[model samples]
Target: MPIRTEIVSQDRIVYQGDADMVVLPGIDGVMGILPNHSPVLTALQYGIITVRLKGEEYYFTVAGGFVEVQPDQVTVLADAAENVAEIDVARAEAAKTRAEEMLKEGIPSDQDRYLMIQAALRRSTLRIDAVRRYQQGRRSRG
Candidate 1:
């Protein structure tokens, strides 16, 4: 049995479909969810979310959120989420560069600000990496 999954961001629903499996970037580590898995409600980290459906895989870059898992469904309420297909490579690159520069300069005076910047850097990096990996996969397959 496939698990019903929905990923929602602040602006819109990022994805909604039935997936055979889902791998989420959890706070502790990656967590894989399958059909009939035990119930869980956990905080997610900035990283990639992989969904497998009908033998095909979909990738998304998710920036921190909470995931709730039931016996039959999984829901991701993300701070921000973008599909690999929708990602603009140039924009992601620019954001990554900006984040890197900010990190280099250091926001050490404020712990909260420093951590927030670090998270942004991580999100940007994950997006760039995801897009490149998707493009590479397409090229290899085609």
Candidate 2:
């Protein structure tokens, strides 16, 4: 039996499918969930989420989120999330650069602005890394 997995960001549902396994970046560490797994509710860290079905896998970059796992379903409510295949590497690199530049220019007077920039840096970095680590093979194959 496959688990029903849904990954939803603030704006829309990024992915909804049945998977043999789901790996999440939990706050404490990475956790893998399979069908008929015990229930869990946890905060997620900024990292990659992996969904495996059959012999294939799909990857997504998630920037902070909450995951609820039940015996037959896993739902992710992410602050921001995107499929690695959909990511624009150049765009992510540019955003990472902008965030780094802002930080190097000196901390912002507004704390919220600083946090926002940091968050952007984290998200962009996660997206870039996810693509590098997971999307390359798919691209080469295609």
- For candidate 2, the per-residue lDDT at 65 reads 88
lDDT of 1 by residue, 34-90 (tens): 999999999998888888888788888899899999989999999998887788878
Superposed Cα deviation of residue 139, candidate 2 (Å)? 8.5
Ten residues in a row with the worst lDDT in model 1? 133-142
Query: What is the alpha-carbon lDDT of model 2 when measured against the actual structure?
Result: 0.90
- Candidate 1, TM-score vs. the true structure? 0.85
| Decoy 2 TM-score against native | 0.94
- Report the number of the highest-lDDT candidate: 2
Residue 38's lDDT within candidate 2 is 96
Each prediction's number of clashing residue pairs: 0, 0
